[model samples]
Target chain A: MPLNISQPKRKNAISLTPLIDVVFILLLFFMLTSSFVPWRIVDTPLSVATDAPAAPEERVNVILTLKQNNGQVWVNDEVLSLSDSSVFQTLVSDNGDAVFIIQAEDGVTLQSLMSLADRLKLNGAETVSIANAFAMPEAK
Target chain B: MKIAAKYAARKANDDDNMVPLINVVFLMLVFFMVAGQIRKADPIPVIPPQSINDTRAATDPNIEIVVGADNILYVDDVLFTVEDVQAYLEQAFSSAVNPDAFWVQIKADGDIPLDSLRPIFNQVRLAGLTKVSLATQLEREAK
Candidate 1:
């Protein structure tokens, strides 16, 4: 007796195009989500007299300036009205180890400045120095 | 004939191996998504105190608090009560390896009241973390 044998037939080839597309899509998703972190900036006012060339070592100091216009207080150029919530508490909470230098315009009112100093001292700031903007002569 | 048939069989089997690549991609996707979920400091709008001295280098990975025009308390952008802040700091200080090395920076509007500022310091003391700093700007020299 004779036996007959048959071989299996192959037809389809695996396609790589779809796999590459999925990999790229995942890469793009991660890149976009990671960049969403927000950045913030705050501005304060500086006294004209205290505005002078600073030595390199003194440049890193954080300065807080105050000015008053028509009984309204401006802190770091941002107007602070009593209606605003506890903004002072927020400031104390965020800055842990920074040095604060307060520079106020002459005749602006010491009551506000002194009050700020007292608060800063209470908030654990080691030094809250006041800069006399009027003590120095006006620069040309 | 045999060699040609073998090559064709090998090519057909390669398609099934693609399952591993798909598994790897999914794993990486899950890892990154979890990492992104961790809470980070929120950008609080603050008028950073300026200084005439340019001696400070910008520090990284520092916690930020924003004092809005309307004196509200915020930590990492979340509105927090004074007591809440105190509780939070207590936990933070307790976990720190060295409370002395851990610092808290405060950026306050120059006009904020002294009365409102006292409780925060009391909280800092309660936390036992002594190092603290205030952010300020340098007084610009006259032109």
Candidate 2:
């Protein structure tokens, strides 16, 4: 019997199929699990009942009332359009250290109140507090 | 012989074609992994109000309260009433490592009425957690 030795052939050490499979899985995971919304925070310091009351003499207080029916805002007694930034800017600047008490009446959307609070804080109001007008009384 | 040669060529070409696809897929994977934030979805969909304030919200807070436009409340994805939230907050506060530093993040729908949202704040107050952040989106335009 004559020895017939076949020439050695090159063999693929690793398959690309598995590697591609993993990459595809990762791509799918990221595509399905990620969120791209740009979220920001507006510091709304809650007036906890536990805090000691500040001195009334030193800090000025400004009342920002949001009316439900008209979608208007009132800085104390004077009503101003929420979009009018100039007047509110002046109000914020005049009372630099004032604590703005935002009172949103019934039916006022949370968005309007948040926008006004954001404006006040942006204009350099030191302390902005929301008055809990709709706070449900103690329900045990 | 010609047919075998053509089949071999086709096989090589098929592998080469996959390289570009793999490269593009890798790029997309990296882009999504880096650019996107992985967060649990909110219990209810909420389109928050927009603001020019550039403060970024904490990625994860100790307490997250979600208020829907329909006056529904969700605490940690569980439906909660005003009274129930107060109890939940108090319990959360006690177990917190630093109770005073634990702030609550409120994600409320822009269309939610203040009447529906205020009681939650009052509940948070009763819990003794003073610090609160209202989640808002960055205003897109000059307005």
Candidate 3:
């Protein structure tokens, strides 16, 4: 019997292993680079006191107390909402030297505090400080 | 005979294919390790407040304070006490690698009322570390 011989046909095929490996690398690159919650810094005024030349007319200090009265915010003793542009203008308009002291009551949201801060800053209340008034007494 | 011979050749090449796959994966893993910021996990759960003025992406910091919604304080693994935390911060600041460029960040929960947050602010101030920043979730990019 004659030995049978046949030509072996090679099938054309594209391997997906490299493509999958590349995709995995890309996925990991994004996972590592991306931050979950974009963190931003809101600069709070420093409590450091600076000595100034006491002028003939000293700047009148304004106290805009933030107290939650019946679940509402009272800004500068006025039941003020952030929407009222008049209240922001009035609080910051009177004098150039007016330094607004924000005395926020415990349980008042920072959301409101920040909004009030923005308004105070926008209306030109040069320096705004969060009061450490309610701070606990120093330990013996 | 030819078909059997061809099958044997292809099997020989497939034997060492895993070596190249491992090499590519190793390179990618190293790339991620170098490029990412690996922050210490917050001790207590903190959901930072949202802000309309949040613009800048927070960069590297010298100190970080996490304020939970329930007003519990956590300085890394240590349970923060009023005096201890202050003293720790004071020490950290004084012995800091770069005091002039030192910065601190407070990661406080949005639900934490301002009143509840008073002591933390006071402690930061009393530590003689002025110009501390309150952390906020970046709302959007500026136009």
Error of 2 at B63 (Å): 2.2
Relative to the true interface, what fraction of contacts does candidate 2 keep? Answer: 0.89
Which residue runs does candidate 1 get wrong by more than 4 Å? A1-140, B1-43, B53-62
Give lDDT tens digits, candidate 2, residues A7-122. Answer: 46446437789999999999999998898878888777765454577556566777778887365787768888767788778988888888788877778887787677777776
Write model 2 residue lDDT over B42-103, tens digit each, in one string.
99888998777678855567899998878888999999887899899999989999765788
Better of 1 and 2 by DockQ: 2
lDDT of each: 0.52, 0.79, 0.68
List the DockQ of the predictions in order.
0.07, 0.61, 0.33
Poorly placed runs, candidate 2 (over 4 Å) = A1-14, A50-54, A69-71, A93-97, A121-127, A131-140, B56-60, B140-142
* Tens-digit lDDT string for candidate 1 (A9-115): 55554577686687768766775555332222222222222357765663234566656523344555676552333565555556665666766564443345644
Error of 2 at A134 (Å): 7.0
Q: Extract clashing residue pairs from model 2.
A: none
State how far residue A119 of model 2 sits from its true place (Å): 3.1
Interface RMSD for each of the candidates: 11.7, 2.3, 5.1
Q: Of the pair 2 and 3, which is ahead by lDDT?
A: 2
TM-score to true structure, per model? 0.36, 0.81, 0.65
Model 3 pairs in collision: A106-B115
lDDT of 3 by residue, A1-140 (tens): 87777556545345656866776777576566544666788766455434775466465777766676333346545676666677677767765677776666666777666666666766667776654433443578
